[model samples]
Target chain A: MFDLEAVSAQWLGFTTEKMTAKYPVEHEPIRRHCQMVGNTNPLYLEPGYVEKTPCPPTAIPIFALPGRLPPDPKPRTTVLDIGLPVMGQGFTNMSREQEYLKPVYVGDHLAMQMRIVKLYQKPTRLDPDSLWIVTEDLITNQDDELVCLVRNTLLNFRTDEEWSATGVTKP
Target chain B: MSRQRYWEMVEVGEGMPEYQLEVTPTLIADQVSGSQDYNLMHHDRAFAQSQGAPDMYLNTGFIEAMLCRLVTDWMGDSGTLKKLGIQMRRFNTFGDKLTIKGKVTHKEMNAGEHLVYCDVWVESDREGVTVPGKATISLPSNQLNH
Candidate 1:
């Protein structure tokens, strides 16, 4: 059995290196990205509209990467390891919250920092044998302001017996 | 656009107007670019499949933003979104048709303000599975004095 308390304790005082990167708004990659998301709001694309509002729709809120963080052994996953399960396995992305304190233009540079906030465990009521582990991440900007917070829950069921024991029911 | 206050007439269990959106790679890419998310799983199909994603990429935070926008758009400027929670049950891939729907589930008076709880989700066009989530909004009540 995993030590719920011990694992929770590990999450405490758990910190990762502060990552800093600046993304120029004028980059073609940025423009292409804006076009891909289907945001027809001229504020993001039209340079003329940008001259008026000066703030692109792709700015601020979208610039905050929720789960962008360096890998830590404490959490036991790589950048690739993050996301929902493959086939038949159950995973739930609990929530993502963001707030924009300032505007970002096409040429503005955004600085980012990421850290682990918490880790906890819960049991599946449907399948007594299944345990669900959750991890929380906080991503902020250079000004030390919070941009977004993401909480992801991973369900670990090693076997069909465990899955059945956990009373796995499809929605 | 003039903002309208939603507090005048809203009841618990009232369904808000639905908004239909089409999700495409271009759309997903725009959101990803705006958000500065370079995760290949969201933009690159070959990478996503290598990582176990069914499709190339999916919209990240826009889903929640759209839901919040839905309420704010309906509530006009008078309502403020206080909290929003979402569960990404399945991947919303490129070129997927998404319908955002919500219903006011609960209402209460708090601290001289009218608070409404709404359950919302993005349903896949092919599969009806609702990405489960709920949001809370604080609106100026006509009866309540600020």
Candidate 2:
């Protein structure tokens, strides 16, 4: 078994030197995001509906959250998977916590930096060798203002071999 | 068009009407294609079954979009979503009845805005509370200028 705790200790507080989106937020991708959800609120799509609001273009739906948005061209994975590669184990998304701090606009250039905030291990009678990886992604807009904070917890299970190798039988 | 809910009209502990969301194959396909999250388990049934999933599961982006719709559908155009969070405990697979539900947990007046906090979840026939999360929204007051 690899030294999971030692490896994780090295990763705590690890953050990327901010990563900027390859492209700015676009209408087509935003439209696709809306259509997928069947959201027809018009604030995001219909210019006329938005015209009735205080700021016509300020009400784009949350689908346009460029702060946490995937790169324009779309890939199998997301830019937010900051710490998954290090664990080398199958994991399931357990929870996500977000705080929207500022308004994100379509033309804003969004960038993200991530940190491994914590590593929690819980040994249960049923799944004693499981652990949770908590990562926080601090997202910012062009002005360097923090627009969103997306924190996620993933339950990573150790394989039988891994459990045997770790020598800690009970989780 | 959906109902336009204002800050004055909503109250703490008020329950937002629940809606049924269907997880279909074509819908999942559109979601994966749109988000570019082509996880094999989300698109390929054979591959999914090999991994012990009964069928193709919905991707995280798709679920997030659906959750956004659930809130925005209630808040209307003037409302701004400050944050939306979700945690998945199980697969939102095809043929499941996704019942989206939410209730206001906390509300406060702050900095010329009405901030509402809610506890939300997407439950399915297969997995109860497959995705449970929280959201914070800033809405324009119906009575006062925000």
Q: Give the residue spans of candidate 2 off by over 4 A.
A: A47-87, A123-127, A158-171, B1-3, B49-52
Give per-residue CA lDDT, model 1, range A120-152, as digits (tens).
444443233344545444445455665444454
**lDDT tens digits by residue: candidate 2, B1-146:** 56668888888999877778687876776776565555576777776654446777887667777777778788876687787888776788888888888899999898888989998888998778888888888888878755
Worst 10-residue lDDT window, candidate 1 chain A? A71-80
Q: After superposition, how far is residue A132 of candidate 1 from its true place, in Å?
A: 6.4
Stretches of candidate 1 above 4 Å error?
Answer: A1-9, A16-94, A97-171, B144-146
